[model samples]
Target chain A: MFKKVLVANRGEIAVRIIRACRDLGLKTAAVFSEADRQSLHAALADEGVCLAGFKPADTYLNMDKILRAARETGAQAIHPGYGYLAENEKFAARCREEGFVFIGPSPENIRLAGNKLMAREMAAAAGVPVIPGSARGVVSRDEALAIAAETGYPVMIKASAGGGGRGMRICSGPEELKEEFSIARAEAAAAFGNDTLYIERYLQNPRHIEFQILGDSSGRVVHLGDRECSVQRRYQKLLEEAPSPALDGVLREKMGAAALKVAQSMNYFNAGTVEFILDEKKNFYFMEINSRIQVEHPVTEMVTGIDLVKEQIRLSAGECLDYDFSSVPGRGWAIECRINAEDPENSFLPSPGTVERYRPPGGFGVRLDTHVYQGYSIPPYYDSLLAKLIAWGPDRKSAISVMSRALREFVIEPVKTTIPLHRRMLADKSFADGDYDTGFVRKFIPVDEDED
Target chain B: MAESPKRLEIRAPIAGVFYRRPSPEDPPYVEVGDTVKKKQVLCLLETMKVFQKIKSPADGKVVEIVARNEDPVADGGLLMVLETD
Candidate 1:
């Protein structure tokens, strides 16, 4: 095990990693930007380094500075707690070059998974089911139209290098394709510096289910289970739950096997997520792989009784898989609501300011993961995530009931939050019946009523 | 001087740490009473590991420096005051 590890990220995830390291008897070093001098992550770590700027590139994404801090702190490893440089292949390679263990997958695996087109090809080659789409980048208008017709109308034009819902357009008919194609191309060029676009058959009302897979250096892999992350706004997942209400024992086993296959194809080790879009007919299609710890990992941990962060560190330290995959025990359902500091009433504009009052819900089944307190000022330079409120119960219904009560108890004053929106979502009959899809939030939360 | 010069505030365009010099070993970009031309580099706003040159909007004399070196500043925070003739 690493004696000391440097966390190359910030906010709740950084705090999460630091706590894990402490529990494993490892000292932690936290790197923060100038704006995050008083951040909870920095205060929690045994040692802290100020990277001297507010922007992500200067702080969390500054590989040289982060590596230097690790060296200075004598940290034997670095844990990138998602986002920023967590999925950056170069940063992982640099850690190896600098002789510090990166507590995640190898650089090669990250690079392969980072490219959408290549990842799809790899998934298909591994015999994993993928969505029907063009074989390569759609070059000319004629080719795009042809591919659209073959794949059927309602095809998705996506950037080859895109993620997080950017550079993507869903066209239902021929007329919309031309305008959407050009617009997607321009957006892709501006966002990813690549005009390369691919076409895929759009699956309407699919449930976004992802399996959490963990692997060791010995090439042994196992999956924890699936997470239902369909409750999203603009492709940003707002809520996640384990033991997806949609999946049964048979479907769960099938998805788990597919997730393992994806990991095996790359010899992927450490913690990673294989995302699949499951249609209403129970057919699952490979979406992409997230090659790091995810924001919604807590739901899996709550249900499976697994410390994923500790597992990542142990695997990176060359430890073998300690648990059996086939017989992994699971408790009842767990649901997590990502409480972000955004005004849902005001088009979800970021609400960054001092937290005049702070009170988090506490009960038998509720857990709050956050880095904020009274008087803590939320800097507008980073993600708007304020906290994650997870509720675990004997069943999905109980979990939802507990989450509803817990969300009502949680409070953060002055700064508007998505708490109200979450409250509404929990009360909605569709959400309670588990009949919602990825488009649930968009329809549930109506457009600003005052908007022209 | 027929009339007092109009004092203009040079505010930060983004939230970051304000640096008075390009590098640690170099002298400050400008001092009180230093004349600057339009688009001349006044100071640097270091954010996301990128050093953005904060240039003067117009020819002016530096009258006051509000932000200290390495100060964490918010967007629109005053960095310095310039007197335009």
Candidate 2:
């Protein structure tokens, strides 16, 4: 085991990693920006280094500064908690070059998984079921027409370099495809400077489920189970739960095997997520792989009794797979709500301010991972997530009940939060009955009436 | 000469890191006592990778630069004071 580990991040996740390091009897070095001098993570670590800049580009995202901090702290390993450089292959390679173990997947794995089309190709080559669509970019209208014909109606044309819904169009039939194909190409050319386009069969209201897999350097991989992250606002997950209400035992086994296959094909190690989109009939398709510990990892941990962070460290140190997951069906049900500092009533606008009073929920099966305090001024320089409140119980019903009760108990004064929204979700019959899909949040929350 | 000339303050339009130059290796846009044309680019305010160019609101001589290079300035924070014509 490494004696010391340097965490190159801030906020709740950095604090979370520091706690995990401390639990493993490892001294921790925390790096913070000038704006985060009083951050909880820095104070909790054995040593701290200031990156001397408030912006992410000069601080968390600056590889040289982070590497310098690791050297200064005499740390043997660097653990990127998430975001920033967590999935940056270049940073991972740099850490290895600097003689520090990067507690994540190899640079090669990160690079391969970072490219969406390449990842989809890799998964398909591994015999994992990817969404039925063109294997590569459609070169001409005739090729697109043929692919769409085979893929059936309602196909989505996406730009190779597109994001934020730009350069994307959905065609319902042959005529629509013909009309929109040229326009999509023109839009892609204008937007991304590349007119390369691909087509995919669009799945309607699919549930966003992902499997958490941990692997060792010796090519051994095991999946912990699934997390239903269907409740999203603008593609950002707001809530997640373990052992999805949508999956049965048979389907779970199949999806779990597929997830392991994807990892095994790439020889992927460390903590990673194999995301999938499940249609209404429980038919699953590969979405993409997240090459880092995700925000909702706590839900999986609650049921599996595994500390993913510790496991990542051990695996990075070249430890063999220890636990047997052959028959290890996870225990109980767990749900997590991301408590962001945003106003749900006002279109979820960010509400960063000092927490005048802070009172957290307690009791069994309730856990909060946060770095916030009563007087900690919420910085506008970073994300608005203040905390993650998780609840666990023997069954899904009890989990929901516990979450509702916990939500009521939690309070943060003056600063607006999504607590009321969660409460309303819990009270809604469709949500309580798990009769909602990825579009649930969009429909559940009524549009702001004052918007022009 | 008895009455002191009124100085106009140039405040930041948004909260971000203030940069005096377009890039790290480039020279600063303007310095104290440099005469600046109306609507001339003076500096930049960067937020989340988006660079917003701060232009001179009026033709003036740069009297004082309140914000240092690479400093984090809040929205409406003072950046410079100008002796306008």
- C-alpha lDDT (0 to 100) for residue A282 of candidate 1: 86
TM-score of each: 0.85, 0.83
Q: lDDT value for candidate 1?
A: 0.89
lDDT of 1 by residue, B1-85 (tens): 5688989999987666799997777899999989999989899886433357889999999999999998778878999999997
Best by DockQ: 2
Runs off by more than 4 Å, candidate 2: A139-146, A158-197, A448-452, B1-85
Q: Which residue pairs clash within candidate 2? A: none
Error of model 2, residue A258, in angstroms: 0.7
DockQ of each: 0.07, 0.10
Model 1: DockQ vs. true structure: 0.07
Please write out the lDDT profile of model 1 over residues A1-452, one tens digit for every residue: 77999999999999999999999999999999988999999999999999977767677889889999999999999999988999999999999998999999999989988888888888999999999988888887778999999989799998988876767899998899987888888778877878889999999878999999899999998899999999988789999999798888998988889899999989998999999999988899999999999999999999998999999999999999967556777899999999998778766766677899988899989999999999998886788898999999999999999999999899899888889999999999988888889889886565855332
Residue A169 of model 1 has an lDDT of 90
| Per-residue alpha-carbon lDDT of candidate 2 for residues A37-64, written as tens digits (9 for 90 to 100) | 9899989999999998777888999999
Model 1 residue runs over 4 Å out of place are: A448-452, B1-85
